[model samples]
Target chain A: MVEIQNTPPHADAEFHHHHAHATTSRHEHGHHLLQVSHLSVGFRMYDIDAPFLSAEQRTVNVIDDLSISVHEGEIVAVVGASGSGKTLLADCIMGLFEPNAEVRGEIWFDGEPMDAMDLAAARGHGISLVPQGVSHLNPLMRVGRQVDGFGYSRAEQTERTARRDKLFSRYGLAPEVAQLYPHELSGGMARRVLLCTALMDDPKLIIADEPTPGLDLDLAVAALDDFRSFADEGGGVLLITHDIELALRVADRVAVFKDGTVVEETAVANFASPDLLEHPFSRALWHALPEHGFSANDQDHPIPIQSTAFEQGGSSDGGDATC
Target chain B: MLEALSITFGYAKGDKPLYEDYSLEVAPGERVALVAPSGRGKTTLCRLLAGYERPWSGEVLCDGSPLPSSGTCPVQLIGQHPELAVDPRLRMEKTLAEAGDVSDELLAALGIRQEWMRRYPHELSGGELQRFCIARAVTCRPHYLIADEVSTMLDALTQAQIWHFLLNWQAESGAGLVLVSHSPALVERVATRKVLIG
Candidate 1:
C-alpha cells in the first residue's frame, strides 16, 4: 500500500484563511469573472450510407443546461464521472468546440457577453486552457519554445524566457528539459509542461480539464497548490477533475455534475456531511468516496434529485446564491 | 502459477536497472495488486509477466517451467492505454476475432454494445475501446492475467462494472490476476494481497 502523508495542518489553515478572505472580498464587487448560463452543446453527425439515398443526420446532445460561474480569487471545481459532459463544459468555455458542434448559451466574461469571435480574440490573453491530453503538445517543437509561444520582440523574448525558467523550476523541471522534444519528456514532465504553457500567459481565467490524472500525488497536489495561489491572487480558475479528494482540498466551491447538468453547487464545507448536500447524486458521490468504504450498492441506481431542487438555484444551502 | 525469479531488467545496457534482482510469484486463484506511482516500472513488470519483454538475467516461469517462446501463451496482459495496443485499421470484430471466438455473455457483462463491433477503434470512446480490449483479453481464458491501469480511462460506473466482471471471472476460472494500479482505495478493495514496487 502507498502511504500518503497527511498534508501539513498549516496548509489547510492557510487555504481556509485565503478562501474566507477571497470569498468576502469578491462578493463585495458583485462581478463574476466567468458566467455560463443554461449552456448546451450538441453534435451534428451525418450518416453517409443510407439505403433510401437521402443522407441521415442526427443531433446528439452532449451537454444540457449546464450553468456555473467562477468568481475572481476562487477555484470552482467541476466534479463528475467521465462522459458526464465535464470536458465539454471546459471546451465550450475555451472556444475549442469542433465545427459540427452546436452551442447555445450565454458565456459572459468580465460583464460582457462573449461570442466565438470575442472568445478567439480573448484566448491566450484573457483566457487560457490546460487541456486533458498531453498529446495536445506539439511533438515537433522543443518544450521551451512551445511554452514560450510567439515571443517576437527582444524584450518580450527576455520576459518570456525568465517566466519560462521560473515556471520550469517551480514545477521541478530541469533547465536541460527545455531542450528536449515532447516525446522525450516523461508523462509527469509532459503534464507539467502543459501546465507551464497555460501559465506562460497570465490569463484571467484558466480552464484546466482533468489536469492531474497521470501525475503522482505530490505533483498533483503541487499543481493544485499553484492553482490555489493563482486564485488567491484574484484570478479565476475552473478546475475540472474526477478526483474528488484533490478537488475538495483546493476548491472553494464544488459543482456536482450528473448526466449533463449541475445537480448541486455547494460550498466545500458542505462536503463534511452527506446530509448537507441538496442532491442525491452529490450524496451518492460522497458515499462512493474511498473513505466511505467504497460502497458499490448505489452504483446501479443514481437517484436523480427533484427537478425543483435544481430549479431553485441548485445550492445546498437552500439559498439562491452565486459564488 | 506465475513466478518471476531474481529478475534483473533495464532499458539500456550499463544503465541503472529498473528492477534489480526482483522476485514475485502469483499462484492460481490469487488476486495480487501491484501498487506503485507512475513511471515506476509497473508497466515493465507487467510486460515481463506477460512475456512481452524478457528479463536480462532471470526467467519467468509458468507452472515451474519457462514460458513458451511462441504461439498463444497462457499469460495475457491488458495495457494502460488502449489506443496504443489496438490496430487502427482493423474493425472491432476483426480485433476481437484475433483472440478467438468471444462470447455474447462476456460482451454484455463488459457493457460492449453490438453496434461497436461494426466500428473501428477510432470511432469508439476510450472507455468503449477499453471494454473491447478487456473482452478480447479475457476471451483467451489465460491462466494468468495482468491488468496495467486498465480501467484508469473509464468513468466511475464503468470502472465498477468492469472490475465486478473481472473479479467474478477470476473467481470462477481460478486464474491468477496481477492488478497494477495507482488508486490505493481500489487496490485495497479488490486485491487479495498487495505488493508495493518503486
Candidate 2:
C-alpha cells in the first residue's frame, strides 16, 4: 500500500521565492513559474465482469501525492521507464486528461490557480509543449505554416516565416522543407519540426517529452543544448525523457519517476555516484546507465512507497541533500 | 547467406537515390548492426532485405538464389512501430498463428503471458505488443531476421530483457540477425559486426 503525504506549505513558499528571485524581480511576493502540490490522478475503469449491471468501480491511481516545481532559468528533467506515468503527468499538467480521469491537485502557474480556461490559454503561449510523437504534426498543412501557428497578418506571417526558417536551419533542416507537407518530411525532420513548433512561441515554460528519440547523437546533443540555452535565458524547462544520460547533460535537477509518483528529485551532480541517490529506483536507473556497465538486474523489483530522500526533506528547495 | 548486390533504391521515380550502389552481405550466425541517423532509409533498407520492397537496380539473394516471390519468406523483418505491423481487427493469438507454429517455450521466454493472446493489438502496450511481434518473427524460423529499433521505445529493463531473449534465440538457431538502430551503446554491446550508413 502506498502512503500519501502532503508537501508542507513552507516548502512550496521556499521554492517559489528561490526560483522567482533567481530570474526576475517583478514579483515581490514568492511566485513559482509552475508548482504542483499534492497532485493525484486516478482513472475509473469498469471491472472485467458485468460492465453495466454491477455498481463496482475500479480506480487505478496513476499518480499519487506528487509535488514538483519548475522555476525560471531551471531545467528539471523527469526520467522514468515507459508506462511509468510520465506521459500522464504531462497530460494532467496541460489539463488534457481523459474524461474518465479524476484529478485532485493544486496546479499553480505564475502565482495563479489554473482553471480550465487559464490552462487552455496558457497552452502554446505561456507554456509550450514538445510532444513525444511526431504524428502531432498536421499532414495536410505545410511545415512552415504549422510552425507559424497559422498566423493571418501579412507582416506577422513574414516575421514568423523568418523565425521558422532560422530555427529549421539551426535544427539542421533545409529551408526547402518549409513548403513540404508532414508526410513529405523524414522522421528526423518531423521531430525537428515539432521542436520548431514549441520554440515558435517564446513561452516562459517549455515541457519537452522525449524530444530526442529519433535524432542522431549530434542532433540530440544540439537539441539538448537548445533547451539548456532556453533555460539560461530565464525560461523553465520540464524535460521528460527515458534517456538518463542525455537528461543529465542539460538538466539542473533530475526527478526520478517510478511506478507513478516521483520517488526522488536530486541535483544532477548527485548522479555521479549511486550512493548519492536516496531512492532504490534512482540508484537502479543510475546503475542501468551505459557508462555504469548497465548492471541493473532488478527486473521485478517493486517500487518503494516512500524514499528516505523524500522523508528527509527532499522538497524542491531541500533537494541539495548530497550536493 | 543473405546478400544485397549493388542495390539502388529511392521512394520516388525521379528522386535522387537514397541508396546508390549499396551492397551488403550477412552470413549465418552473424549479427550485423546497421547504424545510421534517422530517415537515412534504414527502414527502407530493411524492407528491401525482407522483400517488402523491391530494389530499383540489382538483386537480393538468399543462399546464392533470388528471394522467392511467394510463400514463406526466409527473411523476416520486424519494424519500429509494432502497431502499424499488426492487424487491429485480429486477436494477438491469431496474429501469432499467421506466422506459423509458435512454441509455448518461445512465448514464455519472451515474457508473453497466456492471457495476452486473447486481447487485440490495441489492448496491449507498445512493449507488450513488441514482444508478440518478436515472438511471431522468431517462430517462423527464418534464416535471417531484421529488427529495426525493436526496443527503442521500451523501458531499459524491457529493452535488456528483449535483447537477452533474442541473443539466446540466435545462439540456439545460428540464424543471421540484422539490427538497425540509432543507439550507439546498444549497437556496441550486441553487434558482432557493424555497418555504418548515412
Per-candidate interface DockQ score? 0.25, 0.19
- What does fnat come to for each candidate? 0.11, 0.15
Per-candidate Cα lDDT values, in order, are 0.74, 0.74
**TM-score for each of the candidates:** 0.85, 0.82
Give the C-alpha interface root-mean-square deviation per candidate. Answer: 10.8, 11.1
Per-residue lDDT of model 2, residues A111-195, tens digit only? 7888767887888888999876556788788878889877469998889888888988988889888899988876667777887
Q: Predicted chain A of model 1: TM-score relative to the true chain A?
A: 0.78
lDDT of 1: 0.74
**Candidate 2 CAPRI grade:** incorrect
Work out the iRMS of candidate 2.
Answer: 11.1
